[model samples]
Target: MFPRLKVCCISSVEEMRLAVRLGADAVGLVGAMPSGPGVIPDERIADIARAVPPPVMSVLLTSAQSADTIARQADAAGVSAVQIVDRVGPAVYARLRTDLPGRSLWQVVHVTGPEAIAEAERVARHVDAVLLDSGDPTLDTKALGGTGRVHDWRVSRTIRELLDIPVVLAGGLTPGNVADAVRAVGPFGLDVCSGLRTGGALDADKLAAFASAAGVQRLA
Candidate 1:
């Protein structure tokens, strides 16, 4: 399957429009987080989620630690999917599957080392997809997302080979290296944030370059 494109940290309707126009399969809306960038209010997330048209996923990104809390936040935001940014227990995911039926729950697996592959395997059973990221939630400041550093693609490829579910790759992806990343990791999707931005704002040229490099053509 062709690798899909997801533009994260979409803060406004304008950013959503830009992302959809650039052929993004999904757009991430950041909710409250303990650290890192793109932390916005749930109310704002709801407004953007409502405005997003069909065929484009409005993903609510959260740092909530429990299944119930994440489910409630996703429900209240009215988003199509919930991207879990924290390292929650397996029971939490089990609960999410029951509580948020029909809604996609994406678990973020920070590739701190080879152990991440095992973590991905464990979490894959509960969530629809596993996103391999470069953030270390263990840090005292907690760098969940928006960290412009790439994880080991070789490890990601091993994880992808092991899991039956789709694996999405994130962290430090840019127009210059997305094609290489696709070849190396072979992930089902690519999620970008800081790579497609300039001066803390989404850059149209960068977005277009990234989409094109990722083989996502603009919809007519």
Candidate 2:
């Protein structure tokens, strides 16, 4: 099957609708984060989530570590999936499984090095899918997602090969390089944030080009 398209850092209901109309299979609404772009209020996130039509997922990008806090944030946002942008233990995932029964839990693995392979493998069991990103949480001022930088595709490709669940590739993907990313990693989906935006606003032309490059046909 063709890889799915996910547009991230969506700030408003209008952007969400545009992404869906342009063939995005999912839209990412970023919640409060220690350091990252596109962090929006919970109320706005909930509004966007509610506006999203079926078959199009509303993914919440959260940095909450505790399962209870994460679950509460997810509940407030009313998102279909939660993308954990920081490292957490297995216990947290286990609790999330029970707390958010039917919702999808996606873990973000920062591909800083070959060690990321082990990290992805460890979390693969808990999450419904793994999203490989280019962010360093080790920094004093944690750089989560929305870095707009690319990581080693070879490492990302290895993670995709090792995992049984779907893998979504993020970080610095653009209309120009999306095809190369697809060829290199062969992820189950493609997630783009800064690449599809111009001056922090979602650019229709960029979004369309990105979808086309990723082999997504415009939704009828």
Q: Candidate 2 versus the native: TM-score? A: 0.98
lDDT of residue 53 for candidate 2:
89
Which lDDT tens digits does candidate 1 get at residues 28-59?
99988877777778898999999998878889
**What's the count of clashing pairs in each model shown?**
0, 0
Per-residue lDDT tens digits of candidate 2, residues 154-193? 9999999999999999999999999999999999999999
Q: For each candidate, what TM-score against the reference?
A: 0.96, 0.98
Number of clashes found in candidate 1 = 0
Residue range with the least summed lDDT across 10 consecutive positions in model 1: 1-10
| Candidate 2 residue pairs in backbone clash | none
Judging by lDDT against the true structure, name the best candidate.
2
lDDT of 1: 0.89
